[model samples]
Target: MTDKPHHPLTIDGEPRAFFGRRSGKRLHKGQERLFQDLLPTIEIAYPETTLEP
Candidate 1:
């Protein structure tokens, strides 16, 4: 049987697993406020040293 195109993941025409869709739809007001509040505390500062292989 053929897999649906809208399916998140499939292997060999069969559903394999569900990795949640990470669509970046615009955040609502509460979400935006929460993001703004929490982002600074959790933010990753860019490399102090260059990335290496």
Candidate 2:
């Protein structure tokens, strides 16, 4: 037998995981809004930091 998850975690898949479909599809109205509205609000500001270790 293979190790498989029992009950699916109904959580939003964040702060722990992000469960999503492997395929891609056109976004619906609500999903579109998430990209147009919510996404812009969380833009990452990059800095001139060096990656030297």
Candidate 3:
């Protein structure tokens, strides 16, 4: 398991606990290509509103 940083929206800003294989396998070549090709098209800018702590 890896020690991943928690996104602020996560439970009280704690690292998530995982009990199973997080990702059983790495992305295949075609999947990798598609991710590279498509991710930017669906992305959004971060919200400008102030976040509650």
* C-alpha lDDT values of all predictions: 0.73, 0.66, 0.66
Q: How close is candidate 3 to the true structure, as a TM-score?
A: 0.36
Superposed Cα deviation of residue 19, candidate 1 (Å): 11
Clashing residue pairs in candidate 3 are: none
**Which stretches of model 3 miss by more than 4 angstroms?**
1-17, 44-53
Which of the numbered candidates is closest to the native, going by highest lDDT?
1
For candidate 3, the 10 contiguous residues with the lowest summed lDDT are 1-10
lDDT digits (tens) for residues 17-39 of candidate 1: 75676576999999999889987
Q: What's the C-alpha lDDT at position 35 in model 1?
A: 88
Candidate 1: where is the Cα deviation over 4 Å? 1-23, 43-53
Candidate 3: tens digits of C-alpha lDDT, residues 1-53:
23545423345665555566655688999999888998868867677997677
Judged by TM-score relative to the true structure, which candidate is superior, 1 or 3? Answer: 3
Model 3 scores what on Cα lDDT? 0.66
Worst 10 residues of 2 by lDDT: 1-10
Q: How many residue pairs clash in each candidate?
A: 0, 1, 0
lDDT (Cα, 0-100) at 16 in candidate 2: 37
Task: Write down the TM-score of every candidate.
Answer: 0.31, 0.36, 0.36
